[model samples]
Target: MSRSPCLLLLCLSLALPCMADEAKPGHMVYLRAVDPGIVQDIRYASAHNFTGHPLDGYQAPECLLSVDAAKALARVQTALNAEGYGLKVFDCYRPVRAVADMGRFANEPGDPLKTEFYPRVDKQDFWRLGYVARVSNHSRGNTVDLTLTGPDALPADTWTPSAHPVDCTAPYGQRWHDGALDMGTGFDCFDERAHTDSALINATAKANRQRLNGAMEKEGFSGYSAEWWHFTYSANTQKPDVMDFPITPLAP
Candidate 1:
């Protein structure tokens, strides 16, 4: 027998929410499409990251962010550009599987890039120390990891699998040259010195950090205390869910 009209309506209503949930992360767009001026140095797509290898699902070295976040970041870039500074992104729109891969890397024994990325910290303590999150906001499509670039910043060096590692917490010029202004430490430094308000850093580093923080904060991004490069776009009204879609290459 056919179902009653009321029952049919209830069933249809129940399915609607599930159908709506599937449409999330669809708003994700290439950051360059919005602002090519925002330099990208996506580490997770290469072997330069803490893992010493490209993370899973990062098929391309591109930055992806929600539409709102991208536009807001573009505004920040424009503001900074007027001051002779621009944003250099390290990572963006991380996939859910990449987060899982990071967890697994921390749980395992090897630490090939330990000397540079986490010399003072143990891999197993990454999650407990707040250096790495099992569920990153980047998977939600609004968080970004970036730094500032200016005239004084050194040119970015080409990273290869065989390059020797340097201490990430060392002084600005002593660390790897990532074509970014001094922000106390290098990207992905898992030490306390990488903290946004760490006292160990010199005055120059502190000033740069404050400058970057102020710029990003003005654009609706909030910096994570543990890592200065980390920021989440809070101005967006859309509530995005975690996504595992592969990071694919953008069209040329």
Candidate 2:
């Protein structure tokens, strides 16, 4: 029952394609590694986030983004750098586990950071108001939450819970400032003032939002109307697929 040499070679060839498919690298890339100029804050990796805990699956404080989206963001960083500004990302390529954690936390009552992050919004209303979702674009590895920062971007506060809680609807600097330019509200502020085009914000904050929006748009990123700091690289030809890979450190 010995097979002919030609038949064996054909069988090997048939298996090669399948093996190659299995060997394809994950499309995600570390943003800071791709562009050293871009800053990463990776909020979910730390306890400063609205969840008041380190979210699951954020194994490292890194910004993971699809290769194409990272390249596009690098271009945006370059454009911003020329204008005496740079991009500071708060979150990118969120793991599905982390998104699930957010959903679970939203369902539980008694939010510790509720005053700072969602004072006016009830926990149950997050899904109804489109603030929290079971699935997020970040899971697709192309969406990013970010803000503009200058060379003198303020340092992050010590982050101890304040004795007097501040409402998320308070002025940007009066509430929680993340060193980036005042974007009308802090990152993840679940309030109408955080809307991309909310007129309640001061003129300076409005101009800053427009500046970031214009820069991202120039590089083919579309801003989310409900969140001033959120944008997605829609120019990518690949269809977005949600992934659950943990944010691990990139190899040196």
Candidate 3:
């Protein structure tokens, strides 16, 4: 696919300010179109977000892609659709600013209690645990936070599969914590219990998580050991500085 030279220049200019022509550690950049298999679909999970609500300067849903990574994602979507499952993307190709926002939140004096999510540890522990790393793969446009939904929803449509708003504060099952029947925890749950193969939860939830893992692995994506919903496209898996660029889809 031919890339928009204007968009590319715009991306470079916006992401790499005049002060620094080169892409910095915390800057956003475009993904080269190496892979078309990676699919793009927004709206799989609840409108709920990690920052506890929508924040200023947020944009609508779109999939960003690294050339090869896009192909892998597209293939993954195709396979899932064949099985009557669809992808609901939370965030992809994040800009470095967004990552900074996360870090800033963690440093804040008042982060919400983690007992409901990271019950074993306090909210401050995230800083100590290194889960929220300074650099994330997402900025490279190769990593994504996602969830599975039924295929009835078209590739461009959004749907809430779990039926309720994503309650990050409630217990696992009631708040979307389990992995088996699909009502487990939200995708970005920052807890040890959200491990890809954790047994602290019920069997049903474990099975559900396993299903997600299986699907991701089949399409060249690997589940984060500490996160069930986090996946990295093997095609272009370089951990880059975090970015917060708005997702811009390739024009059809």
Best by TM-score: 1
Model 2 C-alpha lDDT versus the unseen true structure: 0.80
Taken over the whole model, the C-alpha lDDT of each candidate is: 0.85, 0.80, 0.54
Sequence-dependent TM-score of model 3 = 0.65
lDDT of 2 at 230: 93
Query: What is residue 29's positional error in candidate 1, in angstroms?
Result: 0.6
Q: Candidate 1: lDDT of 206?
A: 93
Each model's backbone clash number: 0, 0, 38
Model 1, residue 71: what's the lDDT?
95
Please list all clashing residue pairs in model 1, or write none if there are none.
none
Query: Residue 209 lDDT in model 3?
Result: 71
Summarize candidate 2's per-residue lDDT along 1-252 as a digit string, tens digits. 233344335335543211111111368788877997887888899887788889977888999888999999999999988999988899998776677688878889778888788888888988998888766888788999999997655666656645455776676657765778777788888989999999889998898899899999998999988899999999987767666556777678
RMSD of 1: 7.5
Q: List CA RMSD, all candidates.
A: 7.5, 9.6, 8.1
The TM-score values for the models, in the order shown, are 0.89, 0.86, 0.65
For model 1, the stretches where C-alpha displacement exceeds 4 angstroms are 1-25
Candidate order by lDDT, decreasing, is 1, 2, 3
Give Cα distance to truth, residue 184, candidate 1, Å.
0.8
